[model samples]
Target chain A: MALDQSFVGRTYPPSRPYEVGREKIREFAEAIGDDNPAYRDAEAAKALGHPDVIAPPTFVFSVSYQEAESVVRDPKLGLDYARVVHRDQQFAYHRPVRAGDVLSVTSTIESIKSLAGNEVLDIRGEVQDAEGQPVVTVHTKLVARAVEAGGTGGAGEAAEGE
Target chain B: MTAQIAYADVEEGTQLPLRTFPVDRARLVRYAGASGDFNPIHWNERFAKEVGLPDVIAHGMFTMAEAARVITDWTGDPGALLEYGVRFTKPVVVPDDGKGAVIEVAAKVAKKLDDQARTVQVDLTVTSAGSKVLGMSRAVVALG
Candidate 1:
């Protein structure tokens, strides 16, 4: 099913503030097997001029992707959750998110297009701190595979590979 | 933030070290829990196969993080990373056996985007099982 083109340019409300904690950052860093001292040691981070231990570059995706649920899961949008696959991801950081920062995300639908019997979605999230200062801009692309009509339907690959 | 590399010393085409990360089922589970991405394809072999994948696979984000480590490890400062991006070209299929998948990452300075801010673009070649998993992978970082 093709996505609603009108949904393009739609903006969603900001989510409640999510507090950045030292332990969470440490856990995420460890999960990725990154032993960067700045992610665990405040002193190490401070030595690098950060007010506190800074998050790894991809940490905000946990928050931003959650906020994007408002759009991807909208009943009116007719998206098939099971058929969706992540395609592309990008982040533009204004500054590294540090421990003790309270952040919120406002999501927007950047674009929607259909190709090769698949629906592709583009979502951009603006991540900000408590004072509304930009922390990072998260852009994600999701692809919904085309169902085969008794034809050999390959597992969704093309869109993801693109 | 202070970077380990001095901007005055680096030029375009500077090569960063190559890194190889081991990806096991346990690591995938830990990543799913920490990142709040509990996609079954990452941890469930049956589910992954049922979904058309060869076997259990690692999350695209997980591969991306492994690739970014090359830059952060070089700069010695996470704050030096100004931008990062990647295209999910292929999935890193992780088998259930004790020896899981291995992701190899190599990076280099592809462009000198700025002088005053001391920012440069680093391009990464991320491969798993000799197949490119992340395409057009790159990061823009500021140097000391």
Candidate 2:
């Protein structure tokens, strides 16, 4: 089934503010095996001109992807949650996300297309600080594999050589 | 704010140092928890095979973050990163055994974008298990 074309350009409501904490940033940095002092030490970050420890660039993906759930799970969209695979990700930052910053994301459906029987959805997340200042923009592309004719509840067979 | 790297010192085609990051099942589990992307293909071998993956695979975002370290380490400032992007071309399949896959990343200055902002674009080549995992990976960063 094709995704709702009308959904394109629709912007969802801003998500609840998520307070960025030093510990969360530290945990994420550790998970990725990044030991950058600026990510874990306040003094290191302050020396780099940040108020406190800053998050790795990818840390914001957790918050942005969470905010995009509202779009992916929209009942009217008819998207198959199980068939989706992430394809591409991009981020443009106005500044590094720092601890103590309360952040919110507003997601907008940039485009929807179908290729090789796969449903492709493009979502752009606008991240902002507590004072509504722009922090970063996240662009995400999700590919929902077309359901097989006789298969149920699984992604379509992986495209050969993809 | 002063960037650790002085803009005058860098030139197009200057290569950043290569770095290799190891990814094991344990690391994937931690990444899954931290990123909130509990995709079974990253942690469940059976679920991964059922979903058409060879075996448990590391999260694409995790691979991307690992690649970014090349730039961050050179700049010495996470905030210096202005733009970053990548295309997930292949999965970094992680085995249950102790020896997990290693992602090797090599980067270089691709272009000098703005003199005033001291911005330069860096292109990265990332491989895991001897297969390219990310395509067109690049980062734009500001230097002093």
lDDT of 1 at A108: 93
Q: Write the per-residue lDDT of candidate 1 for residues B38-133, one digit (tens) a residue.
A: 877788887777766778888898899889899999999888999999999988888988999999999999989889899999999999898999
Fnat of every candidate, listed in order = 0.79, 0.62
Cα lDDT of model 2 by residue, B9-113, tens digit = 999999999999999999999999988888777888888777666788888899999999999989998899999999888888889889989999999999999
In candidate 1, the residue pairs with backbone N, CA or C atoms under 3 Å apart (3 or more residues apart, or in different chains) clash, namely none
Residue A28, model 2, lDDT:
97
> Cα miss at B40, model 2 (Å)?
1.7
User: TM-score of candidate 2 restricted to chain B?
Assistant: 0.97
For the second chain, the TM-scores of the candidates in order are 0.98, 0.97
List, in order, the clash count of every candidate structure.
0, 0
Runs with alpha carbons beyond 4 Å of true place in candidate 1: A156-162
Worst 10-residue lDDT window, candidate 2 chain B: B48-57
* Candidate 1, residue B39: lDDT: 72
Q: Model 2 in CAPRI terms: which quality?
A: medium
TM-scores for every predicted model? 0.96, 0.95
